[model samples]
Every structure is written in structure tokens, then in C-alpha cells.
Target: MKYQDLKAGIRSHLEDAAEDFFMVGYFLRQISENALFTEDGYKSIWEFAKGEYGLSTSSASRFMAINARFSIDGGEHMAEKYIGMGVSKLQEMLGLPDEELEKVTQETTVREIRAMKKRQEAPRSFYGFPKTERPEGSLLTTPGCGDGKYDCFSCCRECAIRQEPRHCRTAPLGNPFPCTRVNNEEWKKNIAYSLYKDECQLLHPELAPVREGDKEPDPCCLNCTNKTCFNRCDVAKKKDEDEKKQSQEELRKQQREAEAKRPEPSDRDIKAFYDWAGIKTTDNITAEDLKKRYKNAGGGGGRGAALQDYTGSARGIRINHKKELTWVQIAKRIKEIQEAEKKKADFVERSNGAQKNVRDLIKQQEEKRRIEAEEKKAARAAAKLQAEAEEPGKPEIIDGDFREVEDEPMDDPAQEAAKTRDERQEPEPVLCDTCEHEGECAGKKTHENGCMGYEEKAQELEAEAEPNPEEYARFDVESILKKEKGYLDGGREADCPAKFIKEHKILVDALTLLLEKMDAEGGAED
Candidate 1:
């Protein structure tokens, strides 16, 4: 026949038998076994299933596997009975024994065969071991002592290892050996040779027996503890304490190497932190406080121990976690702090000089203000004394007070008291000076009773005689305050403040020493 005519006939038959499982299996078996599709103008059998047949790849593969299993059994009648079965049912029927296969073939439908197969294959438990079966008479008797009867078959019924193997001896009645039972005689011989050779002596002591015709015919040497004996039992030696110590040391060294590889804090970051904290040494700062500042500065989370260790302490700061460090940062921060400390004395001296300048400026300003006030008081006193010293005249009043004509100024009693040391000195008086009743004076200059100038001269004499105690008190307070201002300007160097600074420095040094001691102890521990 022509190839086109033959192909058309085959395709029409395939379409008609599309739902027929028997024809599907038959064709799938022929295609797979002979590679018939690849021989007939197709690249592969999968492509042939896609193009020529309407079956999926998985369905085609199942049909092929089921057909191959039946062909191996060489049973045409058996294959015919299962050919009508679905691909899944036929696959389950394959490789089953004749009894199981016959039972599955009696199932008229695919669902019935699947259910029967599932029941047959499903185990009661995951382990598939027989439960609740008692040992047979052979297993009930115990074997001879140390005679290599460790196998569960030769063990007594009371043995713990006689679990599932009891089914082997008890299941098939009247048979000397049941099919379930494995012949362990060959396994025993092989394992016995290895144990007697001392390779498995720790596991099986029965194989290490002292046989007959030996000088010392003991079955076992479990309790022999002779030190100098020529023939002693050889055993595995326990590990030495020195070797354990070496291993621990090596582990610590590995940890140190790992810690050393961690990323370091930059010099810029360290200096910025020191400037913010207002302290020169990071060693004085606790790990937790540093972490707080670090987080506040957007430095993120960590133990902050690496930053601490960067101060070149013997031990890394122990915080919430023992953070790793790099050697470079440790060296960098140490150098930076040392240089800063060296320049600290110069910095303090400059600071003191600047304070002195500020104090001098304040003192000059106060002195200028005091001078200006004294000048104003002098001008007011000169004007008032000149008015009182004016000659008698018709009063030219302004703001209800007499105005004096321009004249030579009169002597002030208070100014005279300041100039002269003598308190009993009285000033010479002018007769009826600025008095309205001067025309009625008979002996007004000399008379004490009726003269107004006589009364003023007497008052000036009394003022010269008396001492003002309040003026001296004001002078003493001003002197004390000036001294205090000087001390403050010198940065409180003369007072208890200097002592406090010294004591605080001593405390800081003591704490630094304590921290160093702790670091040394921790490093020793590590």
C-alpha cells in the first residue's frame, strides 16, 4: 500500500479506539518496545504520542510500563484480562503474585481493582513488623552460654530483641523453617571472624573467647588488672588531658582570629564621639552608655564592644554581646587619646588667659561707671553749696526754690571733713549770708542766740565732731567682694574649687586603673 493510504487507515482506527483501553495499552507497548514511532518518520515516542495518539505523556508512560510488566510474565491470558483495565489499575496489577493478580482480575471495574490493591499493599504500621505474636518452641529455649547464640532466633523468648522475628518461627505451623525466617548462619560466621580478629571485640564479647589447648584457658578476661603482665588484654586508650587542653587552646586561637577579622570603627567616628561626650578617654565609658550614644547618633545596633576595644584595652568591653574588633581601630584610638592628653596642659593655659581677658574688661567697665557717678555728685554739691553761699537778695524762685546768682562757690562741710583728718575743725562763718533779717542784726556775727549764720557755723562744728560709722562698713564690704571677684577670675584656684578638681582627677585615675586591672584579668581568662 502507498504510505499516505496506510497512514490514513491507521489514524482512522486510532480515532475509533480512542476510548478503548485495551487497544491503547497494546499500541503503547508496541511503540515503546520496538521504537516503532521513531522508525516511522517521528523524532521520538513522546512526539508520536503528542502527534499520532491523543494520550498525554504520563498516561502513555503508564500504559507502556503496565504492558511491559505483563509481557515479562509471558501470560497472554493474564494480559488480556487486565487490558480492559484503566492505566492506573493495570499498573497496580503488574508485579503482583499470581494469587493477588487473579484476585485483582476478578474485580469487574477499575475502582474495585484499585480498592483491592490498596488493601493488599497498605501496612498495619509504618514499620510493617508483626505485632502480638508469641515466640515458637525453638525460640522459647535459651542457647548455651557465650556459645555465639546472640541472634534473636537462637535467643530465649524473654530476650528484648525477640520483637517481630517471632512471626518467622510461629506463623507457618509444622514447618521446620518458615519462609519469613532468614538464615543468619552465614552472617554469624562472617561477624564471628571479624569479632575474633579484635575488630568488633567491644560490640561482641562472646567472639573473643579463650579456646582449648591454650596456656591460660579462660573464656574471658573482663576483670584482669595486672600492670606488668606480658599477655594483657589490648584496648582502645582514653584521650589525654594534655591533648584536651591543646584542643581548647586551638579553639580559642580560632575565635581570636575570627574576632580580629571584624570591621573597625573609623578614626573620624571615634574623635566625633569623644568630642560629643566631652571626655578624652573612651575607657572610662561603659559599653551600655556607649551603645546608647551610638544609637542616638544613628550608629545603629551592636554590642558597641568593638568601639570600646578600640581604646586598646586588654579585653573588649563586655556588653549585651561580646562584639568582635579589628586591630587597626585599637591602635588608632590609643594614639589619638595619647596625643590629646599631651596637648591638654597647653589647652588649659590658653583657656585661663581668655578668662583673665574677660575679667579685666568687666573691671574696667565698673570703674568707668563709678567715676561717672562721682563726677555727677560733685557737680550737684558745687551748685547747692554755691546757692547757700550767695549774698542776701530778693529771691528769684524757680520750682519753689531760691536761685543763686553766679558767684564764687562756698566750702562744703562734708568735702572738708574728707580732706582734713582733724574732726574738731570748724569753718569760719559769713555774717547774715542770704538771710532776710540781716538788717535787724545788731551783733549777729558774734551773737549765738539771734544770728542765722551763727547757728549754721555751730551745726558745721557739730558735723566735724561726729564720725559716720556706716561709711567705714561700706568700704570693708567692697574690699572683700573685690578679692572674691579676683579669685573667681583666676578660675577659683585659691578656694575649695581647686581642691575639688584635684580630687576628681584622682578619682578618674583610680577608675582608669581599676578598669585596666579588670581588662588584664579578663584577657588572662580568655
Candidate 2:
């Protein structure tokens, strides 16, 4: 094939691919809308596309979006108008408005369409003028050009050429033109006057100047030499006079309406005013005197009334002077003030009482903590004393003096040997003195076979002699004694003294027996 044919073939394939992409988007939209993918054991169309066709979620979503945007009948089918436009152009045209979209053709490049869209979305200048250069209080509703269309540059040009005669020759050619008036030297450099001059010459060739235009033109060009045409113009003077007269007439009408609405003072108000002024009676009170009194009370002469200042019990109270209040209104306001004050006073008293209660509770808690700390200190001291008393061979405090008790002297080895020999030489067995069968037994004959009665008695003694470790582990003697002491000191267990004593005795006996057993075992090991 020729190179041109190859290019043509590639273009054809691209258009076909775009059409195929549109079809895929249409099918995806169908699957998503009808949930058809659920029948194929897929949770969603995106999941189904990814699993079956290896399509990414983003690509699937883009395809669906393109179908929704460009397809006919809400993605049921593709529109024939966009058949050969290709996907790239369609994507770029997504943000274009309907009017701008209609302007796009197959020949229109994506960049041109994008630029057009940006220009349309860009903000227009404020009334064809820069924000900083706009005049304060200028009318925002000024008419546009003679064609009634709001082109920013055209509107500004029309304003300069028609409304402002001074800026006609120097008006700039863009939107947001400078509002400052140009001097003669700057005007000569301005290009707007050249364009205006050319237009004037084209329209009015007969009036075109040979070289120089008028140095100082009149308002009406007919009187070119006269500089005071504006001052002498009857039409302009009449318009100004008419506007002034209308303004004055409106002001007078407003004043008349306001005067009609003004309320007259009643007999009650007059009496109250007299009382407020400290006058004896209203018999001799002149109108001048009443007016003076009202003015002194912050009343105004006309519509611009000042606020009235109250005196006596309602010192800080102020009411509008324009309002014609009777004595009843003033009295009611004073009563409200007094009631509010009473409530505030009650709240303050309650706050003070609450503070006092909090202080008292804090004092009581501090006292309780101090007493508990003292009790704990006393308990530690008592435990120390009890431990010292139980310890063997320790010095005892007698009359505030420590006195060490001397150890018992050890027996001589010779003496111990002699004692043992003496005991062994005795022929007769020792009598079972504490046995119950003592009176009935034949002394040595009954003891020959280890004396069953004596043996029974010995077993009873052995059973009682064995030390029980469980008893020592069961009772924490010092802790129990401290708790009992605390109860006695606090007067909590007054009626339970016998129970305390019994438990104390059992703990002490068990502790003493455990110590003695431990000492005996040490001696045996030695």
C-alpha cells in the first residue's frame, strides 16, 4: 500500500477503536444500571470487568462516565454525531457547556476548545473597570452600548466616547481601562484618539480638519470659538433646574407626612411631665415652660429626637424621646428594674451561703484526715512495742531505762554425763503418772510389752505436742492486734471486748508455740 493509504488506514482504525470504546462504555453502563453482573457471581460491574476482561477500575469508570456524558438515551446507545470524533476530543469536551459544545467540529482541535472553555469561565472585569479605579457611589445599572450587549471592552469604549467627553481621545482599548483622566501630553500618545479620529473622518468627511482640531471646543460644535457654551445652554440649564425643584418638592412632602404622624400629648402625659419637673400644679404652666421642661428631659424639637434620661430611682434608664410614654409605662419599667435587682441580690446571697458551706465541709474533711493520720502513727508505735516484747533476749524498758537480761548459764559436759548415767542405772521403769489406768496396773509387768495403757497415754501427749504451721500462717498476729487496738481507740468495738480477747489469746498462743517448736528443732539439729 502507499504511505497515504497507510495513514488513512490508521485513521480509520482509530475511529473504529473510538466507536468500539463507546460500545464498551454502553455495555458497562447497562451492566451497572441493571446489576446484570450479579448473575455472573460478581458484586459489581467494575469487579466483573476487572476479573473477566482485565480492565482497571479507573478505566472502567472513565468508560462509564464517557457513555453517560456523550451517549444517547442515558448510555443506552451511543450518539451518531460523536461517532468519528475520537475519545480524546470527547473527553476534552466534557466540561464544555451546551452552547460551546455546539461550536465544536471535527476540525476543531482539543487545545482550541479547551482555550475557548477557559476564556468563557474566566471572570469579567467589574463593569469594565478596575476595582480600585471605580468611582464611589457610581451607578452599577448604567446602560451598555447602543446594541445593548455587555461586551467588556466595547462597553468601556462606549462609556469613554459618549459619557465622559474628556476621556474620549485617550480611552484605552481593553477591558478594565484606567479611570484616571489623561493630560494633553499623555492624550497625544494614546492610540484610542487615532482610532476615533479615523472613524470621525470616515463618517463626517466634510468636517475633518486639515491639520489641527479645535483647541478648546464648545459643547455644541456649531459655536466652535465659544468656550462658555455649556453655561449658556438653555436645555442643560432647564434640566438642572427641573431636577432641583423636584428634589425640594419631595423633601417638603416627606416633612408634611412626618408632621401629620406626630402624636399629641394627653392630659396624663402633661401631668406626669409636671410631676417629673417638680412643678406644684399645671394651672399656671405656660406652653413655653412645658417645652423647656421637655427639652431639659432630652426631648427633641423635631423628628430627630434624642434619648430621654431617667432620674431618681431609675437613674440609669433611658427611653427614646420620640416615644410618647405615659406615667404607667415609666412606673412599669421601674418595677421591672427593681424586681431584677431583687433577684440578683438573692442570687448573690445564695452564692455566699454555698461558698460558706463548701468551706465548712473542707474544714471537716481536714479534721478527719488529721485524726486518721494520728491513729495510723499510734498503730505503728504500738506494733513496734509488741514486736519488742515478743523478741527473746532483748533489753526491756524498765522505768524509762534499758536493762539487758542475762542469758542462763550452760551446763558442764561432765555434769550432763553424770546425770545421764544416773538416770540409766535406775532398774525400775518410770511410772506413767498421768495415765488413767495407773491404779489398776501391775507396775513393771504391765509396762513390759511397752504398756498398752502407757503407750496410749504417750500417743495422746505426742499428738498434742506437734506444731501446726497452718495455725501460724492463718493469723497475722501483729496486724490483727493493731486492728483491734484501732477499734478500741475509736470506741467502735466496745461491746465486743470478750470476742477480741479470745481471738487475741488464740493468736498469741499459736505464735508462742510456733516459736518454741522452731527453737526445739534448731537444738535437735545442733
Candidate 3:
């Protein structure tokens, strides 16, 4: 197939590739520590066997293969060929909407990624590495070329052409091998020179400098790929090209307009660092993207507001070409974040409602994560889809292409949500005044594998404690009444411990029952 077609296929396959990585990476990550120890997400078959399903490291490696090979048809390894074509770290190249996050599974967390990075169980025999780290094919020659021995004669001359633009002339035949190579008189030559000579570059060979299934290096680099180099540029020629292209893109246009709308960072107050993506990076993220990620985290799909989000700006952020963000200024910014976080903590401590809302969200998030992990585990095991879930095989579409509109304002909606979750109107868990038992009345399993003895425990604990459980329940009502009024009248403080508060309802209930019995007796006499 043609190279262009292969490139297009690579792009399409990447959508599948990321999911595959998540699947394989997650499984590899899981068995590393306590996977077998947790029965919750394990297969029911594994559970009944009561075995660890223990495997040696080599055997553990096969787990990813087993899952990757999963299919309704059973043994079809569908991902084999497309994975053979090679995947790209193109996901890293794209600028994220500041307001967005992918619909991530539990496997996407940093902790899981940390485990996967230790070793990749990639079967070198099947799929190739995702990042070839380059794009160009052939000798990577250019239209305007020169040749020299000490350095690439091609580069020496390009440097000449750049430094002396008047001296260079366009090749009618279109430049020879490595035609696209820029003249960098100072920058060191790459591996192309240390190994293959003019036979490749001078001759313009058809085969990629790879032979007999050997991996090929990408020619797409800082100088060769003129589009990305900016301040980190080594040569004058590529730098000029980088800036010229940057001004034209529609993305930059929106960026410039949006940045203009917000107050520009003062040189003193708003810190700037080297752009890690090279100079082509505008050091800007769209307000639209951040909101999208935030919404995704909330399990919603809606276009983010066009308003500004100053949350975590990566612009002026210095990261390597690998996009590894490492800079002192970013660290400084993180400290500022910590301080701001402290203020939020203080506010939460002051406001009961805020703390409760945060707690509810945490509970909801944990519940969502538990359900997600269970589904993924089921998918890996090639089990039938769970009836409780929508299914685990949905395609991941994270881009802003699909978004629903919400008419409500963010502030009002947030307030309403906070009130709903944090309002203190609901009753707390019921405790039996008749017992000192923890946990729901033993109708529910303690997960100890026996018939629940909830009533027995309640009565036993009640027999041990002072005051009848029935009287304790009534005391709670009066205590709560006095305590609530104390906030207004400032007369007496009702010291009701959490233990008593919980146990009180049982007493009140019992007293009411006794009174009802006495009334029944009176009615019978009449």
C-alpha cells in the first residue's frame, strides 16, 4: 500500500490503539501488586476455585495477550495487523481543551500508568511500537540540497542557503536525497550520518533505511519538521518557517482572540517559562477544552463555556519534545496552587455544607470507579456483558465534536447541586437503643459468611448498657430539641454524644409502643 494510505490507516487505528493500550496496560498493571487478593473484580470462576490464579512473571505477561485476544468470536486476534503498521504518540501532539478530560477508565489513572511503565509486555513479533518518533519516508532528502563529508554536505549547504539566502538556487529536479533536511552548521548530525551514507541520502533509495523488519527512525524532528520548532530552534531557517506558519492557523487565531479578552499576564505577576513543545507552541489552551474535561469527569457531555479558565495553564510551560513537563516555574505555580488549596480547605472547614457536598462527590466518584473497574475486569475475562452496566465495549470519543447544550448558568446549577447533596434535612442512620451493635440490624450480612445475627447482637449489647434502649431513644429527641434551640436562645447545651444520638430512636420507638399498649388496655375495659 501507498505511504499516504498507510498514514491514514495509522490515524484510524490509533483510536483503537489507545483503547488497546489501556486494556493491555491495565491488566499488566493490576497483577503487579494486589490484583489476585481482591475478589471483587475477579472472575466468579476464579473466586469459586479459591485459588490465587498465581502465575510467574512470564505467565503474568500472557494475561495481556489473553485479554487483547478477547472477542465474541472467541479466538480471533483482530488487532494483530493494524497494530503491525505502527502507532504514533499523536495523542501527545494535540493541544487539549483546558476544560476537558477523556472519558477515562480506572486504567487511565496516574497510579496505573506508573505500574505499566515499569515494563511493557509488547509482543515484538506482533504489533510495533506506537511512536516511531518520526513521519517522513525515504532518504528524507530535500528540494534544495548540498553534500559535504564532515557534516551532511546537504546540511552544510542548507546552512549556506539560510545564512546566505542569495547563494541558494532551487533544484529543478527537486532536491536530491534528504531534500527536506535543513542546513544546521552547528547542530550535530543524527544517526543517519553515523551509519548509512550517500548510498541512502545521495542515491535517494526507495526503501526506508530499514531492512528485514528492523525498526525505522522518524525523520520528523526539530529541524526536519519545520512546523513545530520555535524558541528551541537551533537554526535560523526553520525558526523563520515556524513563526510564519504559526500566524496562519485558525487555532492560533481563536487563541489570540481569547487571550486578548482576558487580562494579559503581567511580566512580573504572570510567570512565563520556555514552551516545552518548542516555539510553535502558543503557550495557550482553549477555555472550551478545560470545561469539556471537567464535564467528562462529571459523566456529562456538553460544550464548555467560552469563558476563560485559568486553572492549570501549560503555556510558558517548559516540557521536552517528549512532553515531559519539567520546569521551576511550573513548580512555583504548583506552590501557588497549594496555597489556594489551603484557602479552600479552610472554607470547607468553616462551612458544613461545602464539606458535605465534597464528601458526597467523593462517594459518588468512588462508586463510579468501582463500577467501571468491575466492567473492565469482566471485559478482560471475555465474560458476557453485565446486566447492570450499559456495557464495556463503547468507543472512546473525547473530542469536542459531540456536545449537548445546557441552558442553566454554572453558578446557579452548582449551588442547586450543593444544596441537594449537602442539605442537612435527612435523617442519619438508625441505631437500636436496645443494642450496642455496630452495622445495620443483622439482616444484612457482615460478609462473615454466616446467617446475620443482627437482632441477637442488638439485644445483647442493650442488656450490657445502662438506661433502657427505649428510654435512650426518647432522651435523643429531647436532647436534639434543646441542642438546636441553644444556637438561638443560648440557655443550655444538650451534650448528646454521637453514640447516644444514634441509639436514641430505638428508645423513643419502644416508649411509644408501651403507651399504645396501655391505651389498648383502657379501651378494652371501656
Off by over 4 Å in 1: 1-65, 72-97, 100-273, 276-285, 296-343, 346-526
Residue 444: error of model 2 in Å? 46
Pairs of residues at least 3 apart in sequence or in different chains that clash in candidate 1: none
lDDT by residue (tens digit), candidate 2, 1-526: 3333432443453366655666667667666667667776886666677776777666676676787878787745667767688778887777665667788887899899778766874322322222223357865644333233332222222233233223232345453333232223453344244434322222222222332342211122222223233322343355556767999999989866874575654333433433444554214444344444443354312333222333222222123322344444544443443444455455446545755876797689668766766776677679889999888896676778557999565489755655667778844334544463434454444443344576776675564343332353323444444543443333222233355457556655665565456566662321
Task: Output the better candidate (1/2) by TM-score.
Answer: 1
For each candidate, give its TM-score against the true structure: 0.25, 0.22, 0.14
Q: How many clashes (backbone N, Cα, C below 3 Å) per candidate? A: 0, 0, 40
lDDT of 3 at 173: 31
* Highest-TM-score candidate: 1
Which prediction has more favorable lDDT, 1 or 2?
2
Candidate 1 residue-wise lDDT at 265: 49
Arranged by TM-score with the best first, the candidates are 1, 2, 3
Q: lDDT per residue, candidate 3, 1-526, as tens digits?
A: 3333432433353356544432432334333233442443543222311233333333333333343333223322333322322112212211111122132232354444334433444211112222112236756432232221112222222222232221112334354333334343333354244333222221221112322332422122332322333222333355556667876676778866765565433322222221211212223433344334332222111235221122333343211111222234444444454444455444435434644765797689668766766766666455433443654565877875767978575578646655666686643444333342334443332422232445576565465443322332334444444433332221112322345444444555554565455566652311
